[model samples]
Target: MPEPAWRNEGTEPDYRFTLANERTFLAWIRTALALLAGGVLLHQFATELDPRIVVTVLSAGLGVVAAVLSVVSYTRWRANEIAIRQGRPLPFSWVLPALAAVCLLTSAVLVVLLLIA
Candidate 1:
């Protein structure tokens, strides 16, 4: 992985593009960190929901999303780097839609839990 970053396989892309890709990957990592924090806070502080499992499930969901994004973001970054080097089209990812769906579903569940509480 480290070697790939330094490899000069294809055309050397601009430092700006590589920097931008690094920033994007950092952003995703930051998002995952925030999600993990939110999950911890909810699990530790929001203790009134009935069935008790609601909070647990919600926290777990956020954790899972965070973990997934942490992994997939690397893959996305690598793909973008490869595309830039090869001068090929970058791959479109489904992560955005999938993330939105996960968040929306989690929000709905939270709303229901709040109502029930």
Candidate 2:
């Protein structure tokens, strides 16, 4: 079998560490999928919320975030793998803070919306 890029570039990392990195990547992908679903559901089925424009904006924001996260996941996975091979500190990713900010904004928007509704 042909070696993957990470496999080819570095000494083999412990299997457990590589598996953990894969899990983290999968988790990010799941989060991205959830955001995509939420955006689609809100846009298509959530007709009762007032200021429907707010809902639309929220939906679009989530979708954009999802797209961004999807791209981030692969880059992060590769960086972490390279770092592991190089025996360097794990590379930092900005996706976490961005994800947190989106979640907090969504929660605040929902809370204010519920209060008004």
Candidate 3:
């Protein structure tokens, strides 16, 4: 693949920082995969969850989140790389709070489902 133009614009960052960024990117990817797996497992093995449609929607939501996260992870990594190379403060992102909110909402829904079941 052709190298990105932005990569050529800035001095190379320290190897340790670059590797750390890569690791963070990988962690995001792993989280996305875990969410996807949870969704599939919920749909396939959660036969007892009430309201089949709710379960289906929740399962699908997880898949969607996973897909979004996959893309977001790459973009965030690129942004961080660029910032690092340019000697700028790392760019702020909403991913953490957003992820926390999603987890909280998912858990609350599951709790409600369990109570109802």
Candidate 4:
């Protein structure tokens, strides 16, 4: 495939930085997959949880978060690559905190469901 125009704009970054950025991107992808799997499993196997609507909504929320994370991860990886090549400070993102909040909410909801069951 042809290289992106942005890749030609900046000096080539060190291979180590490039590889590390790739690894980070893969890690984010893995996390997103895991969340998606959790959603599917919850929907399929957690038949005992009451308030089926709430469970369904939570499962769908996880899938949505996974989808958003997958997109965000790629964008973050590209931005990081550009910054590294240009010798600029990495851009900050709210992705981590937002992900944490979602995780905490999911855990709390699960705990409540378990308690109620």
All candidates' TM-scores? 0.93, 0.88, 0.98, 0.97
Best by lDDT: 4
- Scored against the true structure, residue 31 in model 2 reaches a CA lDDT of 94
Ranked by TM-score, top first: 3, 4, 1, 2
Evaluate all candidate structures by whole-model CA lDDT and list the values in order.
0.89, 0.90, 0.95, 0.96
Tens digits of lDDT, candidate 3, 1-117: 998899897898889999999999999999999999999999998889999899999999999999999999999999999999999999999999999999999889989999999
lDDT of 1 at 93: 96
- Model 4 ranges with Cα > 4 A deviation: none
The better-scoring model by TM-score among 2 and 3 is 3
* Clashing residue pairs found in predicted model 1: none
72 Cα displacement, candidate 2 (Å): 0.4
Worst 10 residues of 3 by lDDT: 4-13
Per-residue alpha-carbon lDDT of candidate 2 for residues 1-117, written as tens digits (9 for 90 to 100): 986777677688999999999999999999999999999998898788889999999999999999999999989998999999878999777787878989999989978887888
| True-vs-predicted CA distance for residue 65, candidate 2, Å | 0.6
Write the residue-wise lDDT of candidate 4 on 1-117 in tens digits.
Answer: 998999997898889999999999999999999999999999999899998888999999999999999999999999999999999999998999999999999999999999999
Q: How well is each residue in 1-117 modelled by candidate 1, as lDDT tens digits?
A: 366553577988999999999999999999889989989988999888877887898898899999999999999999999999999998999999998898899889889988877
TM-score of model number 3:
0.98
The alpha-carbon deviation from the true structure for residue 65 of candidate 1, after best TM-score superposition, in angstroms, is: 1.2
